[model samples]
Target: MDEYDFLGDVAVAGSVDSFDRAITPFLSQAFHAKSLLAIHFHRTRLPKVLFRWIPDKTLRQLFDKRYEKLGFMVDPFFHRAFLVQDWEACLLRDIAPDRFESSEYFTNYFGDTNMVDELGFVARIDNDTAVHLSMGRNQGQRRFRTNDVVRFGQFAKILAPKLRQILINQPADDVVEAQPLDRRFHAMAQARHTNISIREAEVAALIVQGHSSRAIGLKLGISGLTVKVHRRTLYKKLSISSQNELFGLLVNYVGADA
Candidate 1:
């Protein structure tokens, strides 16, 4: 009957490693299971541990002998799995006669799975990355129960927003190509001379979306203080202070067609 809430901690875990450590104790408490494992990624190569449930005595031996020794390239799948763009990529494949398995990923990473039955959400972290989570009960009486699955599913939802932030809210890397603005956001920035960086434009659009500094920070994988700084800079660049004044200042540029 543990009643601890892992929602806040998981959100604060940020990166994969941090998330792994943060969720360990929480998972232990919530699921009351013997073992757990969490794999996180940042592209197609950097598959790092987010957390794990290793009950074996020789953890090193298990990793070295099983994954590396077997030559299974788990890293590729871990790093490349993104939910939004690759919704059709996640699948389930049993490794041992309906025992252990994974949520198989698609060429692009998003997809469905036969691994566990539960509710979940997927989101794009960037143009090339995403993440996913699903919860299910172990039918075996000695292992887990339906209540455990229900509890974990609730916990997982708490992390969804944070996961979205981690995967999607990152500051735009100059290396990645900027996404073409959608009609609304595009119209808002129509007169930015088409030379503004995507990061700047995204911030501008968020501002128009009526997102507060703190809200934008959570959505974009940045600190609220950083959002404030960006807002100030944006004001200076656009020659306005109040968001109320923004539409008027940029109306000439964005509303020109109208």
Candidate 2:
């Protein structure tokens, strides 16, 4: 494909089928993405499936039904999407925390996807609305390169605004706020140790969700050093020596629900 050939067809894509025909070549040729999933997100409700394709049936069910139903509580990507409503392409590794790969969210659910890497392209619709296109690479496929992200991001920038418009013109669905994810930490900690402060629990939750102290601080309006202080205090209160222990406790406490 020439430099201008990729995503050029999207300009005439008026429907999802047309869009797929236009983008499939670029995805397979440029990024080698094995799966492409588009999700609509707003507030606390489960992410609405705009369009999704996963080759394996079990993997698709695990992600769409099971993960969205239960596993989202600990998903770093889900939390980050709502927190920032970032409208750009980002690598999953860059968004996830220092120890996210070790958490149950990674080991149990995300692991099932069998993806070597994930690249996300988000389109901001409004203050609390956005759409995310999640692209994945399987074990045999090459990971997305820098040029892939750059080119896809440029295409998404032109295409995302249309998603915004489509959403605006559509009738709004009823939205019910789900349980606040922050409280899960407090609930889990109090089951064993009652001394954990709310702030400490919040930090612990973010930590287990793969956030760095700096990322947690930015989310909580505190300094990174303060987050570290809270980490030490929380660890002490929970009688834990490391993040691995903390992740273990949360996984145990959150259990089948997660």
lDDT of 2 by residue, 51-118 (tens): 77677776787777655554666755565666565467788887777768876567766677777788
lDDT of 1 by residue, 1-258 (tens): 233445556757666557656666666555544445543334433233334555544543444343321112222233224434533222223111121122121111112211122223333556655555432223232434456545555665566556556645445333322222223344455465433345666666556434567766887899989888877876776666776565344434433533
**Per-prediction TM-score, please?**
0.39, 0.75
Cα deviation of 17, candidate 1, in Å: 5.2
Clashes of each: 18, 1
